[model samples]
Target: MAERYGVVPTRRQRLPLVLGVLVSLVLLAWLLWAAWSHSTPAVAGGLTSYDVVSSHQVRVVVDVSRQDGDPVTCTVSAQAEDHVVVGEDDVTFPAGPARTVQTTMTLRTEREATSVAVTDCRAGSGGPGARAPGR
Candidate 1:
């Protein structure tokens, strides 16, 4: 009988195919690790206390005690009555297992404020504050 149009792959061909798949997997894993490392926070901390020091400025202090390398970049924002008042700011410091960072926010209005929300606070990972995954 005549041979089939497409023959099965021999052992030599299968060996190369397996090796190629393994190499691809290793490369993919490495890429994933690099991305994760880059995104992780270089410093660990959280907002501890915030107070209005004056009519036009407010003082904010954060406590960071979990990180081990590099100073954390802090970003602070303030909002009054659901409207954003102060924009973001960046603060850097030396690497510390535990440390406090303080920043002052200048307000646009001196009138008594009802409520304020401060957000976009983050360290490391680049930028003033840590951004969401898609942001």
Candidate 2:
């Protein structure tokens, strides 16, 4: 018989190679899903309105929602006309009957605040204290 001219994969070798490719594809898919999921925010909410009660105080209202009914934490901030952060506070919401709740927070500022908003929000598992942006 003529000798084989090319490298032909044997059955044993082919089995391992096919399995390796399948495993690699599965791992790649998992990694892609994890990256996509983490890149998006899990919490949903926004600032409803803000009122400057006084030169040193601001009342901010936010509507927060989590489908899982889990508690959430929010950062309320007040900014002066110059776009400087005058006041900031971390407010925690305990688990309640409603998944969506409107929260009112009061922030004390060093000077008058021209605008206020809810800057960031996350799940309650973030623990106590404030969350700096990008955390």
Candidate 3:
């Protein structure tokens, strides 16, 4: 009788090994997804900024907050007719989930105000509060 040089894997042994590897991969992927989803925070509540144009004065309303923390110091800027009308303000708040800051400034230009723009609005770290980072 010829002796087998190497041992061959039986069908039962091969199936269990293949199935075990596939199941482990699937479980690892699910765990990674769950961790990522929980770390990120969603923009809860109504946080928005708008420029209100009127006859005498132009008003800028800035609303910003974190998901679970005190109100962040948001820097606000306003412009009229391509000129820097409002500079910037570092507004802080007490310990809470979120906060809103509203600032208003009067324009002293003789020319009729055509348009108003608000930019450089930021929170948490400090950035130009201009329409967020990547839209």
Report residue 108 deviation for candidate 1 (angstroms): 8.0
Arranged by lDDT with the best first, the candidates are: 2, 1, 3
What TM-score, over all chains together, does every model reach? 0.49, 0.69, 0.35
Candidate 3: regions farther than 4 A off: 1-57, 83-86, 98-135
| Model 1, residue pairs in steric clash | none
lDDT assessment of candidate 3: 0.46
What candidate 1 gets wrong by more than 4 Å, as runs, is 1-8, 11-16, 31-40, 52-55, 94-135
TM-score of 1: 0.49
lDDT of 3 by residue, 6-116 (tens): 667789879999999999999999999999976664322222444445543444444544555643444444445657353433333334554443333333333434444
**106-132: candidate 2 lDDT, tens digit per residue:** 778999999887788888745557533
Clashes of each: 0, 0, 4
Error of 1 at 36 (Å): 5.0
